[model samples]
Target: MSKYLPLSERLARETGDQWRPTLAEIEAVLGFPLPKAAQQAAWWGGASDKPHHRAWLDHGWRARDLDRAAGTVTFHRDPTAGQPPPPAEAPPVIEAHRGVGGMALIGAGVAVIAGVGLLAARLMKGRKA
Candidate 1:
């Protein structure tokens, strides 16, 4: 087995879409310190032939971001790599007549009806007088 197999297993166990592993964290996972060449960004790049690259790629992860200064690499899960696509966001439910607005509309309708009824009552009273 490849020496990087431990790293692959660790990444495979992660359920998040992205992982930011520091160089030290990666070293711990691999059970050894990274080589001097690992300081370079190209060393963390995607090269299917590279054992280290294959360690993550084979598990549906890709090195998308690297921070050489911070000594960190960010791996993103490959959606098309036999992994289920993220659930699509459901459309928002819009109720034109709901909540306080609906209540206000009903209250206004009642007020208008009551006002008309009072006006009719006054007219009838005047006729009776």
Candidate 2:
């Protein structure tokens, strides 16, 4: 439902590996004027998450070489397109405390609580004496 869907279709139809469409040309395809942000080179970067970027990226194109002065953006066919991404390595396993160490920690905590209780009882008894 992106407004730039037409641009996606247009780029999909392009036979060349590279396309340098003018801002005006892109706007024409979108049936609207480009936003003020589009004047910046960063706006045409290869950020696939962006709607405009997705227009090209979904069609196996990646925007680069933005010429703001000339009001043009060069989109090259993504070489990695249709290829599977490299497999991510499994994360390192962290061993949890599973023996006496863990039990000792719990035991120490209980001993501290018991010691505090005994101290409180002794203080109370001395006050009552």
TM-scores for all predictions: 0.59, 0.73
Point to the candidate with the largest TM-score. Answer: 2
Count residue pairs with overlapping backbones in model 2: 0
Clash tally, candidates in order: 0, 0
Question: What is the lDDT, from 0 to 100, of the residue 110 in candidate 1?
Answer: 100
Give all candidates' CA lDDT scores: 0.86, 0.85
What does each candidate score in C-alpha RMSD?
14.6, 3.7
1-129 in candidate 2: lDDT tens per residue?
998899999998999999998989998999999999988878887455788887887778878888878889898998674344699998865567447687999999999999999999999999999
Candidate 1 at residue 97, lDDT? 43
Note the residue pairs that clash in candidate 2: none
